[model samples]
Target chain A: MKTEMAAIEIRNLTYKYQNAEAPVLQNLNLTIEKGEFALVSGPSGCGKTTLCRCLNGLIPHFYGGELEGEIFVDGLNVRETPPAKLASHVGLIFQNPENQLFSFNVERDVAFGLENLGVPPEEIRRRVDWSLELVGISDLKDRAPWELSGGQQQKAAIACVLAMQPSIIVFDEPTSFLDPLTARGIFDVIAKLRRKLDLTVVVVEHRLEALAAHASRLILMDHGKIILNGEPRKILAEAAERLSLKVGIPSVILLHRRLSKLGILEGLTPLTTSEMAAQLRGVLNRD
Target chain B: MIRLEDVGYVYPGGVEALRGVSLTIGERSSLAIMGRSGAGKTTLIKHLNGLLKPTSGRVTVDGVDTRKATVAKLSRKVGIVFQNPDHQLFAETVEDEVAFPLKNFGFPQDEIKARTEWVLELFNLTRYRKHSPLTLSGGEKKRVAMASIVSWKPKYLVLDEPTLGQDRENKLRLRELFEEFMEEGRTIIMVTHDVEFAAECGFDVALLVDGKVSALGSAREILSNVELLKKASLAAPQMAELFLELEGVEAQPVFTVEEAERLILSRLMSGSGRP
Candidate 1:
């Protein structure tokens, strides 16, 4: 039964930052199954970051907020557990990669978490090497964090979390500071990690087109509540519902819908350019 | 017009942020500066407003050397709204935040008040003028920042990643505002990752790679070059990529849905009957 439990479960979660007028998150209930990659997107000030903070025991414990919720990470109550203890179960990556990596070298930065947990020196070395290799930055192991490119820096940040071997990882707008092309590469790395590790991944992002195909689920948030959550393609396929809600449907998805409306396209909603091209070929009366 | 003449810049810690970057922006025109993070987009824009001096070359605005002028003097000709509004905002209220720039240019009290109020109303930030800037959302804070610098109505306006944190709706509103601004005969330059926004804006793009200008041309011409954009760590807009990926289709840089639809129609209805 314990093994069959969801990776994360939240019930009636309501939280307000200290000295703030209203709760940023309101009466939210969400359950992410094990090994699911969920991309959460919303306008700023919509509690996307606050929700991520809750999972790593930062909301009630670190931020000192008025929290009314039961958040269980792998069946352990996040509030009851200290952030330091819960950190092993759930890793958090902030928006700015610069602030997250501070060690002299990439290798040291990734191993910093393992060291704090009192892992054996030999085991720490092996895991640190493995994480660096996993992120494809093993060649940069000795380089300073500040010297790396933004995408590389972010990968180093992710490697830092991967070394801890957390079951659940939540990224708060990981590529907000990156260019679209580099952002696409980062998403590929994350999607690959999700598949290889069987890790439950949650990424809060606004760059939709690049990540939509890589994501299994999409959750739209507004006014601190879940407005829509379902399979990524299905949620994105509803142009009228999404537009009324003010979601930035990816241009590719919107193009597909527009073509479909004009009777130019039919069948499944395409989430990527290649998919849309395939649909175009089908419409040409070709196989 | 603004011109960068073989400009090169090196940060204090010896980081060569820009090297041999030569470019020009015509009067009352729009250009979108784009590249990977740390590719010196901010460093290049800073030179336009005299925020930074070129280490090895020259930058001129209307034939005036930037190195000969102070930032205060250059601000009258060029105004820059930096990335991250919170870093540039310090006033207790949005009103004060918007008023500071006018006061700096030494405008008369009444004129400052008039300009500030007008910009606040124009930017739809009049309601938030009394509220703390730190308390505002990302979109609201961005509006407040834009209202402040734009109050002076500088000849050239430079924005670094103006749409970075904004949602699509807010981005649409900002785009309309910028279009209006350009229509008033003021030059506007923006640094962004929003390829669709760049394409819609129909900007002359300056693509930077490794701190040097790699390519400069119209958005469609430069952005549609998949090999070129990839060298700079960029990907063309999804729709444009679709056109490029589909075999037998010509190299048409269709970015927006309308352009994509039109291209599809030409392919389908015009004797091809393709989807």
Candidate 2:
């Protein structure tokens, strides 16, 4: 059940909605270990969301589809287990916070998930406070979820899921609606949570520059399959063209590519701005 | 020609969203509004097109007081594309979605058809003209939303987070589209958190913080101001950050990636040994 074992294992997974003519995900096999920060990215309809749903037991439980293949989460078969049973081990935060938030105030919203599991009142109270503090929104506990800003509401939503103390957390474009500053703050909170709790993190995002520095492994999916998966720097360097085809590479990556083409940057492929600056410094100092 | 005079807005729940925010947007110029989630950027943008009436003070577009005009009336001068495409799109087909606004403005049938065709072509949505609005991808939905407002040809366009779901190539295309609009003498005010987009689009920049105008100047001035950007909870564009970290050599913050490359190449060509 720990991260040393596979947190999630998918084999030959293929799924198609009842109304769809073609499969959204096709013959996909992937393994997600515990305590790893994994980033999933692909084109809009490339089945990243569908794949995440399968991993968290939402495929057969929440959504009915022509599902083929086996999926396991935390040593349990997702097909056999309902989401209610898996909720304690895997937490899913959707793209839009409005869809997930139903409570009146921030505190009640964070406690709602734990309450559904029939947790003790005292334990629920403790987890709510701890989750709010983890997401850095304990101060807004009294405010209505609707009254909060888009970023604050997203934090509250994350806190709600965190209160359940899931071993693995999956985020589907959590920062898509947020402004840049708030997006950075949310990523910071994610980093803090991953380190403090040693939880497995998987996030699907289009904005790579923001997530690149923090992700331990970057998985690039295209047309319902994983095209690239490795250390962020290695996959980025090896699959630059495919990535560009899928979601379009970030500006920083393009710059690094251009520098490499001109023979200015050697060996090291910088991913973040700070890394790029350091590379430039090394180049200048060598001269 | 867009002007705000001591504009202050307090929501019905008594939360002060904007406080004494006053600024001017010139004709045919692009302005980028940067802010945190609660910095009141959306509130300020709503005033441009009369979506929200100021609780105190005044807002005028092209010398006409906004308080005296309705959204439909002001929309002729100001077209606003909201953040969520779902909130603005109601028509079944993409063509109908873009044409609805034109029909509401009472344009002739032929004119609506012509304008819809032109805007669809501009956004590369001509292929999906007959497609259902619900069936489009997220980036395509954003384009349709933009096309819906732009078909009206408002003199000034205000977009809220236009590039939220866009890929890099689409983002580049959007920059080109904004440039074309500027060339046509249409003013553009965009609310965005993508500092890199702000820099590449060649727009003057404004930082909104705590419901007030924290900093306003050319893109070079605002992007290079690390202290000001940090105070507003904004990250500088990668090029700007790189330039800030470089030692000895002096250069204005390069806004675009191409410009940054050019700056580095020029420095190397000149044989400037100073790091």
Candidate 1 steric clashes: 2
Alpha-carbon error at B33 in model 2, in Å? 0.9
**Tens digits of per-residue lDDT for model 2 on A73-124?**
8878899887888989899987667768988899999888888899999999
- The total of clashing pairs for model 2 equals 1
- Count of backbone clashes, every candidate in sequence: 2, 1
Residue range B173-203, candidate 1, lDDT tens digits: 7777778778888899998888888988888
Each candidate's B-chain TM-score, in sequence, is 0.92, 0.93
Q: Model 2 misses residue B261 by how many Å?
A: 3.1
lDDT against true structure, model 1: 0.83
lDDT of 2 by residue, B1-275 (tens): 99999999998888899999899999899999988777888789989988898998999988989999888889888999987687787897899999998998899999999999998987778877887776555556788999998888789988988886676666777788788888899988998888888887768998999999988998878887888888777888877767777742265676666776787777777767357
User: Using alpha carbons, what is the TM-score of model 2?
Assistant: 0.90
Error of 1 at B183 (Å): 2.1
Question: Where in model 2 is the C-alpha error above 4 Å?
Answer: A1-5, A57-65, A241-248, B91-96, B106-140, B248-251
lDDT of each: 0.83, 0.82
How would you encode candidate 1's per-residue C-alpha lDDT over A1-287 as one tens digit per residue? Answer: 13457899999999987766778899999999999999998875578878988999877887786999788888788888878888898999876577689999999999999999999999999999988887678998998887776567888898899899998999887776678876776688788888888999999887777788888899988889998899998888764345533567777777777788888778788788788878787786652
**Can you give the TM-score per candidate against the true fold?**
0.90, 0.90
